[model samples]
Target: MQYPEHLAHFASLFKKRDIAHFMSAPWLVSSFREPVWRYNFGFKNDQNLDWRVHLCDGSLLTDPQHVKLLNSLQCWLIASTENAAGPGFTNSWAAQSASFRRTLTVIDHILQSAEALELVEHGLSALTYDVMCDIIEQIGTSSYVAVSTYDWNNRLTDYCKSLLQTTSPESIDKCLEEYPTLADITPLQLEENELEIPLELISRVRAALYINKMYHSNPNGGLNVNSIRVSALLYKDTLAGKKRLKPLHSILGFIWRRDRFIREFDGVPVTNGNPDRMTRRDLVLYRTAFTFLQKISALDFKLPSKEDLREIATFKVTGTAMGRFKNVPTPIIFKAIKDGIELHFEHGPQLLKSYLNIAKYSLKHMVNITGIPDETTISLLEPSIAELGVQYLGISTRSSGRDPGTELKESKEIYFSKLRGNAGLLELIGVYYGAIQLLVGATMAKRGSELRDLDPTNCLSEDKSWLIARIAKSSRGQKGRRARNARPIDPLAAEMVQTLIDFQKDLIEIGFIDQHLPLFSSPGIIGTSSLTSCDVYLYYKNIDLFCDYFEVERDSLGRRYYIRQHQLRRFFALVFLHCGYGASAGILQWMFGHTDPAHIWNYITEELPGKELRNTLSQALSERIATGGATHYTDVIDLIESKFGTRNVSVMDAEKLAEYFDFLMETDQMTMEPVFLESDTGLRVDILVVVRKQDEMG
Candidate 1:
């Protein structure tokens, strides 16, 4: 039989090197085991660590000691409970009165309000089957038994020697039954120069058994933090060739060496022999590294200060800094790689600064040559230092590599420049276009013909002045009294309807409407053609592509300014809040199709800055309600002096003052409160406030 040249060469190495030394002791190969996952892009160190699981099924170990080992393993795997029993003990001595009971209930409610519990439940969804098995096996085996650093290659080699001396067809057939389709796998056969035989057959069996240790033990494998920690420790111990039992000493050459197994089960490190200390220290180090990686990954693209730079330098895995993490554990090394990435990220701002300095010096020289060197004009050429560090390494500008003069001649950019100058027109046009899409979608979605049977004309009526949209579904009430059927939109979306009416009339004269007289032939587009949802996406995609037209940076994550159709609800809702049209949560909830008022709180809080916004808003509402009129800042200060005998209202900014006034209106503390003011011309003016009644007030 002939073999490939590569196979023959690989077989020669097995003949020369003892298999047990090669398979069991990875430390002999290298002091530091390379990790499975690499942080930096480079050629990897050879992966020499291989735990043979396919051979050992644990069925080989059947003794009374094994049962005791299993029990201890289970005990070690049990989770330790941290008690909050101090409150319970305190309550035991205290009175069991109604007030005391009420206080306890309130405390419990506060405890439950924490968001950490919700986040933990979310994280639990990511625990996979392989992760669970790794944990459980580590606990049960006690870094002994199946998890051996005791060289099986040596044991197999000795067996092959005896088989070679007494070579027979029957014995070979029996060996083939166990590991079929293999020859010259052992040391003796390899020593005989049988290069044509499949020598990997023995190692392949070991690999299969190792896999079985992780997942094939049970149908529904289990997982917890303890299992993960313990498994990592076992892997470390195996690689280091520490605290392994001799094969001849264990019962049936498989069960735990009774003395060492007990120590392992007692929470002693198999490698270091520290009782009551298993893999906890190693696990902590790994976890700490993981946490650092997570933090670095989540860090926003901000320019790190001097202190942040110092902290980042400690874990960096590049240049001279890589020496700091050279001999650290694999997990820690990965963490260092993450740190290096963050360091690189932070350097972006510094790189930008360097480029600017070079530009500034060049500009000064050029201007000097021109004989009109103005320091201010040269300084103006420098860009402002952005708060965010640059994510993209390459240099880019709003002109898309073209000079500003050349860009100005482009039609798209010219049109965009005009639109930017007239913001009100831009907003009104966006609102009009967005409203058409929404109304059409809503009407179609309600009728259950959104995707399949879209005929934009079906939404139109005889009168071209109005359009309707289905905002909510009709539901049965008490005594089968059904609610109103798909409410009309003459008032609900009045601004959009009116804009559509005018737009349709203009387009109708151009002969663009369908036979049914709908405003859209199919749907409305930014261009002269009809559009759909797909068209809307393509429109925004093109807008993003033409970022130079809008004078904004293009990001890999998509548009920094280009608007999607769905964002219209959030846009208009924010507009309603900022413009003092309708700021209450209920109005926002209805407009945004949110069932819970709490969901709206996050949006409102994000929109309105200041840590004391909620408190300030509440206080302002109370003051306005007490006054029963639209109170100016001057009047409010007077009221404060009368109540607290002090005036501090003058310190507040105009923006803060407006926020308070808006808060009063949104909460309906005082409805349409009127105020009389004297203008600069000494003319008396009547001002109408924007407050509307809340549901409770009504």
Candidate 2:
């Protein structure tokens, strides 16, 4: 094959004799040509000479192991040179020989050093005895000697060789029967201070396995902590050459090994020559390393701290069952209340205060929604308000005029009546009051009272101030409710109210309310009455603002207009009529708080249309239902799904589902036939395929 110019350049770089060039431009040595270099450099102690000689020689360092051996030999030569030339050097040949002999001594010293051995030991930390045996079986003794320093120290070399030879698959099985402690051999080697294993190497192996698992499982492949941990161990073991398994085979091999271990020793004693109770120390070590890697990987690498590493390691040790001989302990939750004042300072006091007020309103609305007894809801909210940092004066159980609760109740009723008179006003006040306060407060806080009080009437008028005070007082009373009542309202209901109120208050203090209020309110004047009118005008003027506040967007003007409070009764009446409760008269009677059907009929006959074109659609729907027509229901669904796609079909996809629906509708497929899309039971499948063919003729 013809090589690219870059490859030719790489070849030349590899052939260069300059040591500096070889060291500095190491990337020039293509991985493909590594074998050639390896063969030439095998187990040679030639430090002064360039790598080009080793690459050209071909005989010695053919294998990667041989190349490593030669590199180690060269390192030994460098270390030994200081000890050479003292006694046996009369000639240059004798001097060279002495240097070579000293190099061997240095190599032997390195093999004996605890530090060097510790590095190797750490590398093997994630490997099991059986795995180590497998590695020996795969790599054989020669490569092992090159990668490892066993050749330098006879005693250690002999020990390793014996261990390797005795730990064959069959031998290991027998050993398990005789000595369960054999499972701890890797740890034993470390304990004896024989080798140092690098955690990095183990981590790399684990990472490879994790990536593979992720790739295979993708989407539906469920990943659990245990599986991930196991995968990591397998990866580490494979990479360290402690397991005779390929990278692709590690996961399966690990499972097989686990099964074999379980099957071979079902009830044997763990420590006393029983296979059933094998300690699995190697597995534990690997698991521990895996856990450490997982945590450290999750942390921000840019600011890696020693404390973080120690915490990760500690968690890994405990989390991975490294020390425990039995089941893991459950994590303990520790709780302590932080000072509220301090928390307020950190989070902004005004914001917190606003949250409390919002929480109160939210709770009140929730009570209204659930039709829970007002007294019970109020009792539940009292403590919540106290906790929220509101100082309460007193709660009057009796509805006295002097009591703030009674005052609030009266105020709320008045507010609601005004809402009935002009529903827009209620919405406008709800939308803007808190928001405007927040914006003005923040701006004032940032600037000064001089700047803040500029539009005091507009920004903090007496009416607005009274509104704030009333809301605050009500919130405090509401918070007390939770503490006093043993049996409270539904937990979710309480939480929702709390969350809504807090969110509203936050929006207010941040100036979001003040900024958007002008879009809805009347444009002129600054008197209290004018302000009230503006609030009322805003309430009705920008219905979209209210919808926006609730994150609910009306799709059509009809839908938007239909949302009016007065229209609600009419709509409900129409629904009843279409469902066949008589005409609009009966609907109005049932819907308008009228007790008698006859009165509703008179009103309907005298006024509004008893039925309309829109009502016809509803009547047709009801008729189809009465006739048990599947086609009608199916057609409805087809229309909905065609309009909304997967979004309208299920709640799981949520926004995505909605987006899909929008896409379908916008693409002009509103009348398209229904498609039975393949989907996970809980998942929404967006794409649609036509279930029925369209007519060929126009």
Candidate 3:
């Protein structure tokens, strides 16, 4: 890399040892508590010399061209380092939006366009402190702008301090003058002004702003300037020549006017009438994972080996053998089990020699309960799952199946610990294993209160008959034994359990389980810890990889439709609700481990049961009103009175009313007809018409 005379001297001050020391130390010198005289090679020229040549990549340049490349090489390295190491470099929306165009311009300079160098140089220089803050007033203003931008409309602002508490309903008129984006309505002030703003009003405001229906809505409609500006950083790459270099202006126009693709509320971009939950990068990752999964499924892969099984299964040597007490060493009991299994072997290798068929019964059971592939369900398990009680048999909640003592927030450790496991998960697995053993005519009789207490004999059986296992509880306050009952498994449930077992075994055989190992592991962590909540997200990444691998086709509108995990959970909840399942909301709330049913509401569809019922009743009433039909005489009387408020329609008898109407119709003293009209909601209404018959004739 080349450097100017003064800059070269500056660079020479540091020896190789000094550079090494600097790398190890946070600060420059031992005495210095701050980053004093820290080297920054990307300084803008004080003389304001043309820095166009400085933006170019310098690695390919000859020695003769080094002088010409000095500024460009230094600038490139500095920008690259800053981008890689700077705070908020990857996640900051503002930084990404601001630098993306300049980054592209530099790329263009390196590849084809020389003119872009000037633009890139100018952008980079503008970002420098000297250019951004030339005067003291400019410095102060820039500082204020930075602070204001970061804090303005921050979500963390005090509830009372925000628009809700500070601005009264009476002050709304005055507030509108400043923030005219609010809907034009006279708000009723709350007596408890100190209370947090009503979320309902926020919703209404969001809805109004989303449609750009606010009094002083921006001409650009719902699209925000920041998103458009950020989009420009990408859009500029499409431009091949200088004529098409109006990146900022063109992007803003396309987003706000020409394309009209993005929508925004409160300066934030939204999609599908909701705030976009995922970023573009996340969407890309998911798409890629989905493609990968699809491709693997289509490939018809072979079964996994014993080594492959080890990769997917979250097993540790800490637990005792299947039949032994918790503290017993597993090897001491394994000998008998291995011998028994080996004696029963047929076409396969000896039980101990191969991974195949070994633990097939137990694995089958686990799969039946999980109902999904290992990779898919790995995230649902917590890191502390192993520490749970043996009696629970499966993943338990952080509180070990007990509710927290208080309403106070659970720490991340405790929250993730026992988030609760469905007994059905472990029980179903056990049931499947038991069923398989029963089919083999193995000894299955066990009497116990809980399913876990029943232990099936491993020894082979001579009799091929169904086993009757009884489970009865002892009465707590009475001496008499409780009546024993045989619990029955429904045919459908049994079939699904069997099917899941088969599918899981197939997954194991095909080596898909082998690929699930790293996914199940917590990245950068060692030991037998289960995947944390964050690690579990690797499942989604796996999906993204699958989609990418298969090059999945986009939708009819050329858009990729990726399913998120949360979306799947919501769909499951909604399905339960739509199927008229009893206590679905409560069930979902329990399943989701939500303290309040309202949290589960997010999973519910917008067309709620109450809302739908109301709509249906409203439609029925509307139809009756439109047809001028009355279920009762009072309904007719009420309708008549509504039309003719002064008339005593209620006093007239049904026969008298009929006779009067007939006389009126015959004598033309009154007229009756139907009047049709349309309402804003698009409903067509028909009204019964009665007027002075003589007046109409005249």
Candidate 4:
């Protein structure tokens, strides 16, 4: 019954080709010469795989070695499909045909690019992991492609290991090239960033956010939009020089000149110009005052034409000629501030107060220099200034009240220079949520979507220790898989989660925001509904605003640092990996949920990701091991001693540690455990390593 080597492979290919054409999936077979897996995503017979999976440009498909490996891969593909519907209709990927084929296309790229096609005789061996890594390194830009490829292959590797039973390699995604190098992390500057974000920064940022949220939630949170719009207009026209405000500003220019030179405010001292000079520093106020005079005033006031000052007398309303009436200041200033009050309550004081102070200073300075306006102008201008000041400006003509700035300061609403005050209600809310989102994103290893979709009602368990979130990425191409994973959070993260829950509840209760939205939804955000989805990508901008507001500084190297959700996720992974010393990388992978990590391992869960990252934590671990740094790792060390004879063997020469590491990885499973060891400094140092043998899988 035993066939010779070539005959055995020939018979195996014959069986696989038969299985392809006769069994579960007949579409997979193109021809005996080359059984490339061609897929039809369009209709039942529509073969638009239009994308194809082939080996070695049609040259290697007939090779005995390739034929066998390709046969096994095809069988796995056929087995991967189940009878469910498609995307949106089902959660499991195999439930739909398209998802599996789409994944094969990603794999196809690696297959086509992989060199040394005959390196492995059959199936995806450890050698295939190396080939995959080589292709992964040359990739650019599309990081998602890299993540997806690794994830799908990891699943494939899992399937292979399950079949092999005793030869499982935990995960092939353990390559560190995807991470930044050690030098990239050193000399970490705030302006130019490093690979890792310091926990101290995250902590300090959280505290700053807490204080800011508390600080801003006062005085009804200044949701007022009036000040924001007004200041932006001013800033744009002045500094931006987009220079679009010409016509209106020009009109304002003349009106200002007329007011200053011809009919100067009543009580001020200097002799009024013989109808001449003027200048203006504008913002929304110039437009507002001009509009109040022309559009809102009953006087039908027309600005004086710059061509003639003598025309001031002719430009009057129903009353005496305008030039003769000295009372123009009071009525104009009063009407502009008063009428807009109902439309913009905060608008009058904050917007026009600065202008009012300027007017009085100019008025007083004129009074000191020389000319006085006639009695008629005096009575009108003086009384009007006092009235406007007392009522709208919050200034007391009777007794001293408070400095305007001091009053606003006490209200503690955020104010930016140039009147860009308090309009950040929307951005502030974003910041508040951004802080929570960053904290949650960093602490919880959820995908951006999972983090965005967290349910306020049930995101937490009754005990409040475990942070529960959905798992979708790994569920791709699998059926009936678990959809959610619950992992423990530190005390601070737990507290933050609770606070988030409470905050969402309050927003819903007040009907200020709708209920049933995800915790991060933009409910109170104008134009958004409770059912709308919020992308986590936008959270970084809000976080940056928070940083700018709080003056989050750079590190010692002066490189500017920016934080992204992915970086936070990686940092968390790194922290969990090295934290109590030799904390298990395997457990970190397990917690990440690429495999049924729960099935084969004990859940002393902890965290960390992939590609030959100089910054990849394996180097860190290797360095630690070489130095004999970690303490109390008896079992792994004993295993090390049993094989290599002594811990010193790894440290002996340049290549020995590499061999030692290889030996440890060759075992069924390796993990580090912490044990207290006496250090030279007399401190209690808890450090160690452990290895789980092939027999320990049970």
The lDDT leader among the candidates is 4
**Cα lDDT for residue 187, model 2?**
18
How badly does each model clash, as a count of residue pairs?
6, 49, 37, 25
Local distance difference test, per candidate? Answer: 0.28, 0.27, 0.27, 0.35
lDDT, candidate 2, 28-67, per-residue tens: 2233234222111112332222222222223333345445
**lDDT, candidate 3, 347-462, per-residue tens:** 11111111122124335555422233333233333323222222222222212233333212545344223322222123222222222222121111122122222213211112
- Candidate 3 ranges with C-alpha deviation above 4 Å: 1-63, 66-71, 79-112, 116-501, 504-584, 590-698
Instruction: Encode model 4's per-residue lDDT on 547-659: one tens digit a residue.
Output: 43333334344422334454454444443434335444343433343223232123323232222111223333444555676435456566667766776734644223433
Better of 2 and 3 by TM-score: 3
In angstroms, how far off is 168's CA in candidate 1? Answer: 50
Model 4's alpha-carbon lDDT is 0.35
Off by over 4 Å in 2: 1-428, 431-531, 534-539, 553-562, 565-570, 578-590, 594-598, 610-698
Task: Highest TM-score: give the candidate number.
Answer: 4
- Candidates in order, TM-scores: namely 0.21, 0.17, 0.19, 0.36
* Ranking of predictions according to lDDT: 4, 1, 2, 3
Candidate 3: C-alpha RMSD to true structure equals: 33.4
Which window of ten consecutive residues has the lowest lDDT sum in model 2? 327-336
